[model samples]
Target: MAEAAELSDQPLFSCRNCQNPLALRSNLLSKNFWGKTGPAYLFSHAMNIIVGQKEDRQLITGLYTIADIYCCNCGEVLGWKYLRSYDVRHKNREGKFIIERAKISKEY
Candidate 1:
């Protein structure tokens, strides 16, 4: 399938429950670099989102640890947040979000 086209200058991504803007199309991590696997879309980036310690899972990626990112409005499992707790060779993907692009809609 073709990627969703941007409707505005900065496409506002929103939650399904409350229609709250979560991220933007410009913030897409796939276009720039390699990202983690999401529900559907690959190379997603969780740049601007809320992160919490509680219920956060520590997923090991080489040496970096990743946590779950929830929706600020609905507390939904939006994606994963990178935690740079380990000492990896390179600190490129230190902190990022591989959000589920399918869960979010491109709001005009």
Candidate 2:
């Protein structure tokens, strides 16, 4: 795993709207059993959420709680999962709780 310091001096990828740095927060499921026998070690970024569109986009009002995994500088919108309401419920399935959304200032 790469350390945050390693990416500190490096240019950051940011959101087009807020211009905040994108942070990498691995999902628990993906953190488990990623490497088997076939493929070496596949660290999937699918778990990450995106915020802005490109470079001049903003964070939509309705679209909140985005799962981000990118840098802050240079406006690089990374992986994100937009949610409508705080109450995300699904029948017969375990509900996911998104604690809160934070603006990333550095890389990791």
C-alpha positional error of residue 105 in candidate 2 after TM-score superposition, expressed in Å? 17
Candidate 1 segments whose C-alpha is farther than 4 A from its true place: 1-9, 31-48, 54-63, 85-90
| Candidate 1 residue-wise lDDT, 15-103, digit = tens | 76667677776666663323345453323454335786634343544555666677777787776666664555635555656666556
TM-score of each: 0.61, 0.22
Output the TM-score of candidate 2: 0.22
RMSD values for the candidates in order, in angstroms, are: 6.9, 12.4
Question: Which predicted model would earn the best TM-score?
Answer: 1
Report lDDT (CA) for all predictions: 0.58, 0.32
What 10-residue stretch in candidate 1 is worst by lDDT?
33-42
